[model samples]
Target: MGWNPFRRAPLLHVANDVGSGPVVVFIHGIASSSITWTNVIPLLAPGHRCITIDLLGFGGSPAPLDAQYTLPEHVAALARTIRSLRLREPFVLVGHSMGGLIAPRYAARHPGGCGGSCS
Candidate 1:
């Protein structure tokens, strides 16, 4: 079989999904994975839906050779993954380090897709 350009990699990997309420998505920094939020998620999970994801090329997410791992690419992958969740309402976004960089960009690009963010 040929290298199928149309066969794209799946969206970023979701590491954790807990609780039930307003949504909160956590993004880890460069050289990190969703596991970084281990202790934090519990505090928020009681009153909100807590979700953590591995950015593209990190943790459980695919690292395609063709990927440049740019800000746009990361935001694009994150948007796709969030869209896949079919969230009923806008959610809060939180990021650490490089993830802190990506979170705001994603919020800017997607608008109401993210109600608020912390970096």
Candidate 2:
């Protein structure tokens, strides 16, 4: 909805990046953004690299005119975002509410890409 000042241009969809260990991806619920994990991220950050996502059209990610916001579309956008990050290994996926529904679908589609449980 607004310009993202958190991360760089392309990675605006992602939230924080802290600590140095295994990765943990967080997907917020409908109508929410990565900020949903503000409290939780710090706890995990101590032992992991926290990467929260702003689902398409929510949070800091832009909402384009041509993109139809759907479950598939959302997942695809997320995939693109993750690919751009170029992480060294698979990550743990965590979601809340609608995001909870989306995470498993992403995990199912990319089985090997997910190293940990989709919580």
Candidate 3:
């Protein structure tokens, strides 16, 4: 298939964004989706803004035919999503398994983008 100039770029899916307070971004592990934080979010939502994402090619997010789904690709998609949120403060990043791998890389590439992290 040929690239179409008019085709809109794909975007990652934000599975859930609950609560309102300090931000807490959650990234799921491989073969998993934002659902991973279902139980946890409810616990933290009262005190923190819980933002859960479905990584590229997972959950509600797109999986472009041209995408390689590499670590960089995943991080890039994540970066775009984070930027779109237009956050006022650095978010606390939390991940599980593969998401654990991604969280640090994201922090390393975009210093100050994350105020803290857990995996």
Tell me the lDDT of candidate 1: 0.85
Residues 1-119, candidate 3, lDDT per residue (tens digit)?
Answer: 54333444456899898899999999999998999999999999999999999998999999898776777777777877887777778789998999998888988988968422211
TM-score of each: 0.86, 0.82, 0.86
Task: For model 3, state the Cα shift of residue 115 in Å.
Answer: 12
* Model 2 error, position 19 (Å): 1.4
Overall lDDT per candidate, in order of appearance: 0.85, 0.77, 0.83
Best by lDDT: 1
Identify the runs in model 3 with alpha carbons over 4 angstroms from their true place: 1-9, 114-119
How does candidate 2 score on lDDT? 0.77
lDDT per residue as tens, model 2, 19-93? 889998899998788889999987888899988889988888988655556676777777767777777787888
Tens digits of per-residue lDDT for model 1, 1-119: 32233455359999999999989999999999999999999899999999999998999999887777888778878887887777878888999999999999988888877422212
Stretches of candidate 2 exceeding 4 Å from the true structure:
1-12, 114-119
Best of the two (1, 2) by lDDT: 1
The per-prediction tally of clashing pairs is 0, 0, 0
Error of 1 at 81 (Å): 0.2
TM-score of 2: 0.82
Question: Per-residue lDDT for 24 in model 3?
Answer: 94
